[model samples]
Target chain A: MRTFFNTQMEVLNSELIKMGSLCEEMIELSIKALQEHQDFYKEILKLETQLDRQERNIQDLCMQILLQQQPVAGDLRKVYSALKIISDMERIGDMALDIAKIIKESPLEYQERLENMASATVEMVHLSIDCFIKQDLSIAHSVTQKDDVVDKLFYQIKQDVIAGLSKNSQESEVFINYLMIAKYFEKIADHSTNIAEWVEYSITGNYVGEEE
Target chain B: MRTFFNTQMEVLNSELIKMGSLCEEMIELSIKALQEHQDFYKEILKLETQLDRQERNIQDLCMQILLQQQPVAGDLRKVYSALKIISDMERIGDMALDIAKIIKESPLEYQERLENMASATVEMVHLSIDCFIKQDLSIAHSVTQKDDVVDKLFYQIKQDVIAGLSKNSQESEVFINYLMIAKYFEKIADHSTNIAEWVEYSITGNYVGEEE
Candidate 1:
């Protein structure tokens, strides 16, 4: 039974990694579509559906483990965190699709700062999942701290959009859409931060920055 | 043991309702802040913290029920749904605070269309939680359908902002801020839709709009 539980956990961890990679691909493809001015909406929508299935499968598996084995302490935390992390992963997929939709509608040339923001958010998603898979506390903490960079980039993008509006209000709609895209990226980073915080909770049983 | 489980479930249900009501209050306060151009940041922040603590307590209680009783079938689903719903509720609280933060920074006058959007979104939140508490499938479905109204209102607000910008390039920052607030309300409605979907899932074991 112990070995079986461990193997099930391994499967859970691997599935989570696969889902995380799907998120990374979706984010990359969305940005690529923007930078190259191509349509990736179909591909992103496909990935989003795949993520939903993955989330349901992982959720069922986690519930089965909890019901069958009734894991306690660290094991219970691991299962609980898996359940929480997948929701965030699924939201990240939705965020990518949102960006794809925006790009499809506007097809704006990617600004340098927006590209930087994209890369930063992608890195945060990657590292947060890595922290969970490896149970690396340091990496999880780093992901939390990295959210500040995304936040700063969002503000910079907002300022740029405002400046563009000030110069030529004709493109106000485009600027607002860009601002929305940046905000979505920031939100994706926030979800990554939530995953990282859950990772920390799984390891230390303490949610970072959570007040008593 | 059965009696004890029943009692614990009762406590869990009541706590969830309390948390849901807190979410409703937060949304109302956020809209009030915008309408009155008053500072509700402190109150919203306090509510956010309270929501967080409520989430922790409810989560712990759910975990206790699952571990102590090992509920299966419908009982298991109920506990799991509680866990998921609280996360969504916490996010609704965060969204309210996000709106409050924006209002604090910018203090844009409330437009009539925005007021309509706010009322629509608050109703969605209210109905979603009501569906969850009462386990009413029809009410849950209504909340899901009502999201379209909020979406339409958001687009209308967007168009108004754009028209305002075309007429006068100045105050573009304020218009953009209004746009962001409108977008936030749309997002809050989206979260409410999610809660409603989960409520349906808890009742029927079917996730509406979930493919395959």
Candidate 2:
């Protein structure tokens, strides 16, 4: 039974990594779709569906482990944190799709600041999931700290949008789209921080985030 | 042991209701702050902190229930749903605070469209929690359906903001603030629908909404 539980946990961890990879792909594609002015909505929608299935599967596995294995303390926290982590990850996927949808509607010209923000957010997503898979507290803390960078970029983007509007160089709708996209990326960064916090919780039983 | 579990479950349910009520109050206060152009950030922050404590207490209770009682199947689902519901509730609190923060930054004049959207969102929050407390499938479904209204209102508000911009009547920063407020309300409505979907899942074991 112990070995079985361990194997199931391995499965859970791998499944999470798979879901995390999909999220990375989704975020990348969303940004690429915007940068290249390609229609990526269908692909993003497909990825979102896959993520939903992954979430449901992982949720079922977590419940089954709790019910069947009756894991105590540490093991139980791992399962619980997995459950929580996937929900955040699923939200990340949704946010990526949301960005893609916006891109589809209003494909604004690429801005260097927004691109830099997107890259930072993407890196955060990668690092957060890697930290979780490795149970690396240092990396988790780093992800939390990196959220400040995303926040700064978001404010900068907001300023640029305002400046563009004041100059009347960009149409209101287009500039608003840029602001929305930047805001969505900021939200994605927030969700990545959430995942990293949950990873810390799984290891130390301490949720270190805004909620605390 | 069964009786003890039942009692604890009762406590959990009541705590959830309490948290849900706080969410309702937070939404109302946020809208009121905007409408009256008053500083409600401190109050919203207070409510958010209370929500965090409530979430921690409820999560601890849930873990205790699962660890001590070893609830299975339907009983387990109830506890799990409670766990998921609180996360959404906490987020709802955070989003309300986000709206309040924006209101603090740029005090836009009261617009009827925004007021109507805020009222609709508040009602959705109320109904969603009410559905969870009562396990009312009809009310839950109603909340899910009502999200369309909020979405429509969001688009209308977007249009209104654009119109304001085209007429060069409102400052770009001010109109952008309105857009953000509307988007936050739309997100709050989404969270409410999520709560309602969880309520349905708890009662029927069938998840609904976009994730499925």
Candidate 3:
């Protein structure tokens, strides 16, 4: 019985890791598409759907594992953390798709200022994923720190866009859309930081204090 | 043993209701403060903290019930639903506080426009809490439909404010803050709708498709 339980737990762990990898790949592909100005990237949508499916699958799998195994102590924490992490990952995928849509709909050269926003967001995504993979709570704490940077960048971009709108009020509609884009990027970073916070909590059983 | 088990489950159920009531009060008071401009009433941070503590406590209670009672089928669903509901409730409280702060800090008001937004949001809150108390899936689903109404109100208010801003751009900062207050109200409505969706899922085991 012990051997059976250990093997099943191993399988669950690997399945969770695979799901996390799927999330990471979706984020990476979305960022690449945005940076390269490739609006025609059909694969981003496919990856987004795949990520969503994986999230649902992982959640269902965790419930089954919990019911069947009734994992104790640290094992229970593992399943619980996976449940929360997958949720955050799914949201991150949604954020990626939102940015992809922005890229697809807008003129390729129009969102140049957003280039900085995407870069900051991608950096946050990478830091979050790294923290999860390594279970490094310090690195996870860092993800929260960088969220402020993303937010600051978002505000800076917003002001610049708003200023442009006020100068050429005719383009206010277009510029407002740009501000929304920046807002979306900032929200994505926020979700990624949320994931990293879960990593910290799962490993340390502590809420990562707000840095700012 | 059976009597002891049932009593324990009853206590858990009572705790769940208690936590839900606290969440409901937080939403109601937040609306009261925001709409009535009673900034002092926004000092419900203690309610948030208490809700958080209750959430964790009820979670623990649920876990203990699951182990001791070994709830089956419907009882199992009830326990798990309590767990999920606490999460949604905690977030709802957080958002309420966020909106409260907006109400507390902002000196500028949009006169009747702010009232319109508050009325829309509070109506949604009323409907959501009603659904929650009744466990009426239909009412819960209907809350999603009204988000668009709140959203339309948001845009109308925003347009009016922006036109007002055009008259005196210095007012743009205040109007944007006002816009955010409306947005936060909209978000609280959205979160309430989300709770409703969870209720539907608890009853039916599937999302009935949110009405936007």
Candidate 1 TM-score, true structure as reference = 0.96
DockQ of 2: 0.47
How does each model score on lDDT? Answer: 0.88, 0.89, 0.68
Q: Write the per-residue lDDT of candidate 2 for residues B54-156, one digit (tens) a residue.
A: 9999999999999999999878888998988888888889989999998888798878999999999999999999999899999999998999999999999
Which of the two candidates, 1 or 2, achieves a greater lDDT against the reference?
A: 2
RMSD of each: 2.1, 1.6, 3.9
List the candidates ranked by TM-score, beginning with the highest: 2, 1, 3
Clashes in model 2: which pairs?
A: none
DockQ measured for candidate 1 = 0.51
Ranking according to DockQ, highest score first: 1, 2, 3
Interface RMSD, all candidates in order, equals: 4.5, 3.1, 4.9
**Which residues of candidate 3, in runs, are more than 4 Å off?**
A1-4, A25-46, A100-117, A158-166, A207-212, B1-5, B37-42, B66-70, B111-117, B151-168, B207-212
State the lDDT at A117 in candidate 2. 95
- Rank ordering of all candidates by lDDT, starting from the highest: 2, 1, 3
Off by over 4 Å in 1: A209-212, B209-212
